[model samples]
Target: MTQMTRSAVGGRLSDDKRKAIALQALARTESIRVLAERNGVSGPTVKMKTCMSRG
Candidate 1:
């Protein structure tokens, strides 16, 4: 993955946050849509994060 600059707009989530959210999804704590909405990202983004966390 390419590194994003500090000045970049609409910043991406940190790896830690992404991992936490992925874990939550795996644990069934909440719906993926809810997690994505609460995190200000799209559902697909959350889904992708979860997929990445798997491997």
Candidate 2:
């Protein structure tokens, strides 16, 4: 799992925020790297979130 941080994007996101991000990942409007960076998380983290949401 990616370490949660408090830099630009801040610490761990709320469940709602995570769900929203997962939805964004599913939308595929942006690359995983771009979405992760924009959200201050790792690409794999976003991927994992997306996968878990599907699960």
Pick the lDDT winner: 2
TM-scores, all models, native as reference: 0.73, 0.78
lDDT of each: 0.69, 0.79
lDDT of 1 by residue, 1-55 (tens): 1113311311567878878878987887899878766776666677877898889
List candidate 2 stretches off by more than 4 Å: 1-11
CA RMSD, predictions in order? 6.4, 4.0
Per-residue lDDT of 1-55 in model 2, one digit per residue for the tens?
A: 2444623343367888888889999999999888888888777778888999998
Clashing pairs in 2: none
lDDT of 1: 0.69
